[model samples]
Target: MPKKERKRLQVVISDEQDALLTRTAYELSSPERLISKSEVVRLAIEKIARELGEGEHLEEYRAILETEEVGEEEA
Candidate 1:
């Protein structure tokens, strides 16, 4: 827990996903690279937020038409 105020969150996952997360956390852990199941869930949440633009974490994908126009002008 950092200085920031934290809220407890509860989530439900399938048995398979739970097992996978446990395995991943164990494999990723080390003296220098310690990871936890909670970290995995937080990472997943951040990825989903970026992909869904729940915030401006990532810009909308560039349009193919815009890319083609830029390439034509450069050429």
Candidate 2:
């Protein structure tokens, strides 16, 4: 399989958010006692995406996605 390029997302967070993620990851680390910080971020992103996908904005969001694709192609 060809390796896919991953886009990097840079976010500025407050100490509270940082602390929550660190604590959450520590508790959720399964099988392996060690936890990847990225896993905490992914869990949050997945939850948000799932909720938004089922919201009234879902159709509107689809329209935005289509427009974004055209914009990307033009870029």
Candidate 3:
């Protein structure tokens, strides 16, 4: 089997976002298996895409986009 090639992405988040990511990964981890922050991010990206494709959470997604725009303007 051939190795998979993956592109890298750089994301900048606030302290609160970092804490939330760390906490979520910790909560999802267990003695048998540990969840990494990278896994959490990939899962979140897949979930968001699935939900958007299904026409679900549009309002919440819009709100997030608006908030992100404001945050970027502030930065």
Assess every candidate by TM-score: 0.56, 0.61, 0.89
Residue 18 CA displacement from its true place in model 1, Å: 1.0
* Overall local distance difference test of candidate 3: 0.95
Runs with alpha carbons beyond 4 Å of true place in candidate 1: 54-75
RMSD of each: 12.8, 9.4, 1.2
The lDDT for every candidate, in the order shown, is 0.75, 0.80, 0.95
TM-score of 2: 0.61
Per-residue CA lDDT of model 3 for 13-69, tens digit only, reads 889999999999999999999999999999999999999999999999899999999
lDDT of 1 by residue, 6-66 (tens): 7999866557879999998988789899899999888877786777676543434346447
Residues 22-49, candidate 2, lDDT per residue (tens digit)?
9999888877576877888988788769
Candidate 1: which pairs clash? none
The residue ranges of model 2 lying beyond 4 angstroms of the native Cα positions read 31-33, 56-75
Leading candidate by TM-score:
3
Q: Which ten-residue region of model 3 has the weakest summed lDDT?
A: 6-15
Residue-level error in angstroms, candidate 2, position 50:
0.7
**TM-score of candidate 1 relative to the true fold:** 0.56
